[model samples]
Target: MGGGWIFAVIVVGLIVAALWAFTKGTPTGRQAGSGSGSSDEVAQLRKNLRVKALGNDALVNRLVQAERNRMPGASEAACYKAAIESWERDNR
Candidate 1:
């Protein structure tokens, strides 16, 4: 009976570990080292827009559009500016 209990515990532990591993597989899509449109840039823009938006959906949509229109090889600063412009345009 004790041996059976141990086996059950081991099986449960293995199942839990497997589930954790599966759920933890890989992170977000953005890669920091991917260059040209790094995660940092995207993250920074998100942060800035979040702050500017102050929980407004309209501003959020503008931010999304800005990010969607982001060009390759564009710097984070440029992206930020563009996003801001989009937000401002829509805001007013």
Candidate 2:
């Protein structure tokens, strides 16, 4: 029963990755100017990832520590991505 969240997160991650890959090269998908718009999107993505891990305290802790040990900024995304990858690996 507890493993259900892992499966859900994996599915969600895959779907998101597919959508990103599909749109990455499109004209509309390519945003310019290095604006805060992309930063907002990244922040939201990290929030959603963290929320998905909420049901598992251990996972959340690992992500938090991972971020702390990493650089002060641009680390949450890496940490969350690592957690998702580890879930995919350990469960298989």
Judging by lDDT against the true structure, name the best candidate.
1
**TM-scores for candidates 1 onward, in order:** 0.36, 0.34
Please, what is the whole-model Cα lDDT of each candidate in the order they appear? 0.61, 0.55
Runs off by more than 4 Å, candidate 1: 1-35, 66-81, 89-92
In TM-score terms, which candidate is top? 1
- Please state every model's RMSD to the true fold in angstroms: 10.7, 12.9
lDDT of 1 by residue, 6-85 (tens): 99999999999988764333232222454556566566556656766786757666666666576655666456556765
Worst 10 residues of 2 by lDDT: 25-34
Clashes of 2: 0
Residues 1-92, candidate 2: write the lDDT tens digits.
Answer: 87999999999999999887754433223234533335564554455445556666676677656655664564444555455445445555
